[model samples]
Target: MPTLQDVAREAGVSKMTVSNVLNGRRDRVSPATIARVMEVVTRLGYVPNASARSLSARRSNIVALAFPSRDAGGVTPMTNPHDSLFLSEVEAQVTQAGLYLMAHSVNSVESTAHSLRSWNVDGAIFLGTRADEVAALHTAYDAPMVFVDNHGTSPHISNVGIEDRLGGQLAGRRLIEAGHRRIGFVGPRFDEPGVVRERHAGFVQALTEAGLSLRPEHVVHCDAGFDHAVAAARRVLAAPQRPTAVFATADIIAAGLLKGFVRAGCPVPDQMSIIGFDDLEVARHVSPEITTLHQDIPGKARAAVEVLLTQLAHWPAARSERRVLGVSLVERESVAPPPAS
Candidate 1:
């Protein structure tokens, strides 16, 4: 294979001129010289040495996608539809920028820091990472980073997320408009300081405005997993006075609740109205489509990549940025007025 030196010799120009042309440093070389160098490169079939370039630049040309994992030693599951879509979009954006993407499962600060350092990644993007873990990772690693769906208040941290509180309010308002008074909320720990907590707070705000309150028994704690949500549905079904409607934090959970209720011989909307967040594809695939709050998954991915790339370009000088996108309601077949008593 022909090398840069060969191309320079064939083009009758110095190696520096060839280097500048190939590296897009156009101002450093004349257009005629650049054209000649390209002709020589095409004739000689010369290919740049990526390793040498990376070594000279002191960069790996690779970024990492740090996925939070429950099992430290196991692979993180991609069953969640929101996670899957977000990953697809991030990969597309990173690849378009000519950078490699490395996905790693992170369960602890020490282990994740070790992995990142070993890989020599230029930067990282964390997905759904907890606030405490993000803080620890920020302190442990000096690399440029961006967090997705994180609620960290640190001025040094950059993040991208949706208007979770507004989404909750929209869901609440939709149900209230449909005449649902006794409503329930199903999601992960609402007391935790994260997206779910913010959503729940907004939901409560809407409820209070309408002179309605979310009952203590109506609040169900279920992780983002489908099976757990199905079990939570059973608990809701068993309540002494069941809620006529429920606001689920995720579409996957809402799908699970739909299944649980259907299996127990309950017709959706007529018996129990459910509204979900994150208008994932699952919302439409279920037997009765779910009404949901639609957030821009692709937009969130693009913003995260853009912020991380900006930080990488500016290094330690780049200021932290937080982007909060809006959400709108998608009306479907899952919400209706309460059943006649």
Candidate 2:
């Protein structure tokens, strides 16, 4: 087994000189020295150790995709179709670019911070973490970072996210034009900052323009899960004045709501119209199909990697920027004019 020291000894040069030549630091070694080192390396069949190379360069050549612990029982962050789609695309891109990919789920902000500190990764891509928590991460780590769908108002953070507010407006406008004044919104609470908050605001904005305000009872603040959404939907439909249409913040919740509506004997679009965000596959798989605000999941994934790579290319000169992906409504069978009152 030939080591870098053996190559350097055979070439009658210093170990650092051999390292410089192997690493293509031509400026650090003369052309003649580089040629000599190459000849020795070839004659000796010397292969540089990847880990040693990375350590010398002060890099791990590793990128971590981190997810905040959503609950006590940690689940794969890809549980959300949007995250799953992003991971599928980003994993290939990261591997093809000659980097190792690590997916980590951390329960608390402190634990998340600790993981980054322990792993000597080149950079990170945070998946759907809260803006405040992300900001805390930024303050704690000096590593380059790219955040996916971080909606926090910060000029110093680099991120890729959809136009959630606009998507919300599109969904609301679509239902409004269909004569749905009694529209209800279903999802997690709007007080928390993130995509949901932005979408919720946009929906409310559109409704306000048409002299329609969402009544307190019409809003269903349920956890973003199947069973919880179904229970909430049943409760909504059971109300004395049920909404003719409902806009779910996520397709998963929308799917559950659809099941609840069916169990209650409601005919989709004919008796109750539905719209959802993310345009996940389940939206189409459902019986009537869901009309949704569609954003490019793969595009978001690629753009985040590109942003991180751009920062890595220019080490010591981090660029604080943001890229906003566009979104539009994809009209499908789930939405129609509300039935007569």
Clash totals, every prediction: 0, 0
Candidate 1 has a TM-score of: 0.87
Best by lDDT: 1
- Candidate 2 per-residue lDDT, tens place, 1-341, comes to 99988998899999988876665344556668867887888789997886887778777778899876565223345687777889888898886554679998766667877887788788889986787887788777888898988888888889999999999999999999999989999988756689999999999999999999988889888777778878988877976688999999988888889999988899898999999999899999988998998999999999999888778766558777799999989988998899986
Model 1 per-residue lDDT at 292 = 95
**Clashing residue pairs, backbone N/CA/C < 3 A, model 1:** none
Tell me how far candidate 1 lies from the true structure as C-alpha RMSD in angstroms.
4.2
Candidate 2 weakest lDDT stretch, 10 residues: 68-77
Q: Estimate the TM-score of every prediction.
A: 0.87, 0.86
Candidate 1: stretches off by over 4 Å: 2-47, 71-76
